[model samples]
Target: MKGPIAILGARSLLGRHVVNIFQELHPDVCLEMWTQSDGVGNVNSVKRLIACISEAELIINCHEARDLSMAPDREALHFHNEQFVAEVLRNSTAPIIHISSTLVQCSDFWPNTYEPEREASKYGIALAVKAYCKSKHLAEQELFASHRSAVVLRIPFLYGEEDWGSPVTDAVMAANIFGSIPNIGDRGGAFQIIIVGDDTPVGDVYDNVVEAVAKNPKRPMSTYNLPFLPLYYIYLAIGWLLLAVNKIFDVSGSLSKMPDPSLLYLIFHHWTFFNTNKSTNLLPDHEELSREYVVKKSRDHYALMNPNRVRTSWQLHIE
Candidate 1:
């Protein structure tokens, strides 16, 4: 753990947090950062990627294709998820810490050979999500097959101050503007969420990564679910009330547009929460944030970003 550490996808949401946390707490540690803009995942950049990590003692992969557009091309997903991972494995012998997603567990196409099926898919999950999950599952398979020292940290929904475009952030915005969330079937779906930009969980994730690098466990690869708090879809109503109060005091502004049905279904319809017993055992110091705290923080952050906009209420009129 003494040498330089390489971080792939250094510009991504989680990647940025990882970089900031490492720099803040361990400024002396050399960090080698590579991002998509730097051609880390391009087919023609294999040699460049190899050279990037050649001197690193540990590699942390935060690269992922999160664009779940309609009719997403399968090749694009594979190229970003599976093929890029394979390239990294081919290039670096450094022990790796990979950031993965819990959505893989909810895909119907995910094979049980890796781990037990966590939940059944709801009827209307977008095809883009299915394709993304399949690609991630394949990436995990690639890592397992490499027979290298690696730790896969599978996480649920992430929210924070900078994650402005994320689903949870969008929900908070919609609630603030409309004073209500669209009640998708069954009051939406259940899921788990964790804050990536906050110090507590980010520190926990970084601590586990450091342990993985230091220990280089005897097992070729280990998978752990990051700590999360359970959140039901209906709980989003809390944001509506919080924002409504802010508007009553003339402290918050409004924005238009509700989340698309496809995105809404993805969040509200699937059961994406997973057990974190293994991660807690690794580092039991994780703190849990209350739902109210998350809602209020998101509200204040949004209002600060859009402070001058006019306020709106349930009557579909600007105040």
Candidate 2:
């Protein structure tokens, strides 16, 4: 008999979706959600988390600090997981699938290889972003070292319908409604936006998680990046310019009410994209996500939900 599949950090945006998908996929399989803070109905304590983990057949770690600014505080960045992850590895005989980022592949220096299996993230020191990358690198190293059954998914630039506040959502809304967007830097700058286009949808990630749970391997400790999305910054840039103009004029544009000049540079200026050949070959259900489809879906959904609303920040009120 298979034990229940426990999802850590189930209160997260991705975590909530995964929980719903898993229930629909396997109604007979018991599902448990755990959060560091008070969870859905009751307060999920450390004891409860451990108990649930002890009995679960599998664990999926969706607990990640999305804010890159927390890099200065190492403990907070790791989420006090020095013993938590190790504890899980020690207690559970089941495979643990951890959600990681493609930033770990980035080097503190430069001339970084987009490949993850190459072990290119050797350097780790700098600003909040670099520190965040280093934390992920070290975490993965420890996880692989601790348990061979552990698996890591290095996702890059995730966008989906559930997150209506994402930068992509802002760009799409501004484009479809206001026809205005802003460029963070000079148009003719030498900084070429090189994204692996590994912008996977949450739905695809959900499917991969379901598959991993179904096939619980004994010695399956490995990290895999989701399929890549090709670079399409030009189209986005045009959209931003339109939104930026509307913002400057103080129009009733949806994105105009939000931040001006856009925050797309956070990703466009950097190269955290990854090579997904391994994930595509390994995960049979893995598919190359269509950036257009995702953007359209997010745009349409947000328009319907908040036709007159505009968001300046992608902040969430976690309980």
Candidate 3:
């Protein structure tokens, strides 16, 4: 009999969705979920983690400190992002799948290669973002050093019904409340954005993890950037206009508030995007979602959550 698959950080935005999907799709598989409340992120809790996963055949680590504002200091970032990973590797022998960020790949240069020594300063990325990136990079290094069977999925900006604080979610929230999106930047950089719920990249993430668990490939480590729809910063202006129109016609009588500027640093600088050729080659049957479909699906999901809100004229036309 196979042991259960343990998911650490099971309460996260991605973690919750993964759990739900697994239950719905593969109900026969046993799953153990651990979150911050379970002391999963605490270095002292490694012993507890070891005990919990002792009977596990696979461990999926969705734990991460992603919010730039929340993880303000370097030590905090290192503790959550890198140190915890090292601790897990030291104790666990189970095949692991780690959820990493594409920010680790940010560079001003095109065709960014995997260079551990790459500095964030070269791309003029902000200090907080830089620290977060460095920590994720170090965590990856820790995994690689262990020479264990692990798969790292580097994902980009993710938005969904439950997502908040992320760039995409922030924009949506700001638009709904203030009728204006905060200034992101001069619109010079390239980016990729993906939805996290229902027939989106969340399924793709599951597919990759399933493949890793089944194959249990005997390589030191393998990394893949999940597929995404490429988007430029300039396209935000159109979204802003649509959001403003929706707010103006909203009958909910909700007063507008000022937009929060906390996440501005993440987008205020020029940053490069990832090339997912490796992921494509590996998942040849994977279908890429069109940008229009993603946008409409995301817009509808958020709109349904706030049912009193009216759709913009432009949005209706597009629909």
Top model number, lDDT: 1
lDDT string, candidate 3, 155-206, tens digits: 7656655654344444344445545443433444333445663223222222
Q: How well does each candidate superpose onto the true structure, as a TM-score?
A: 0.63, 0.60, 0.62
Whole-model Cα lDDT per candidate? Answer: 0.55, 0.49, 0.54
lDDT of 2 at 206: 21
Whole-model alpha-carbon lDDT for candidate 2: 0.49
Per-residue lDDT of 93 in model 1: 90
Q: Write the per-residue lDDT of candidate 2 for residues 142-258, one digit (tens) a residue.
A: 788975588787765444455534444444444445343322322221111111222442222223221222112321212432221222355446556665766567433443232
Steric collisions counted per model: 1, 11, 0
Q: For candidate 1, write residues 1-319 as lDDT tens digits.
A: 5559999888877789788878876799999888777664355567667777888999989887754432344666788888888888877898888877776665422212224334224323533256666787788878878998988877765555555444444434444554533233332234455665332232222232212221122211224332222332343454455457656564333212322223334444544445666555542242465544654565455445441242211111100
Query: Which 10 successive residues of model 1 have the least lDDT summed?
Result: 310-319
TM-score of candidate 3 relative to the true fold = 0.62
Flag clash pairs in model 3.
none
Worst 10 residues of 2 by lDDT: 186-195
User: Which whole-number lDDT from 0 to 100 does residue 162 have in model 1?
Assistant: 53
The order by descending lDDT is: 1, 3, 2
Better of 1 and 3 by TM-score: 1
User: Of the candidates shown, which would achieve the greatest TM-score relative to the real structure?
Assistant: 1
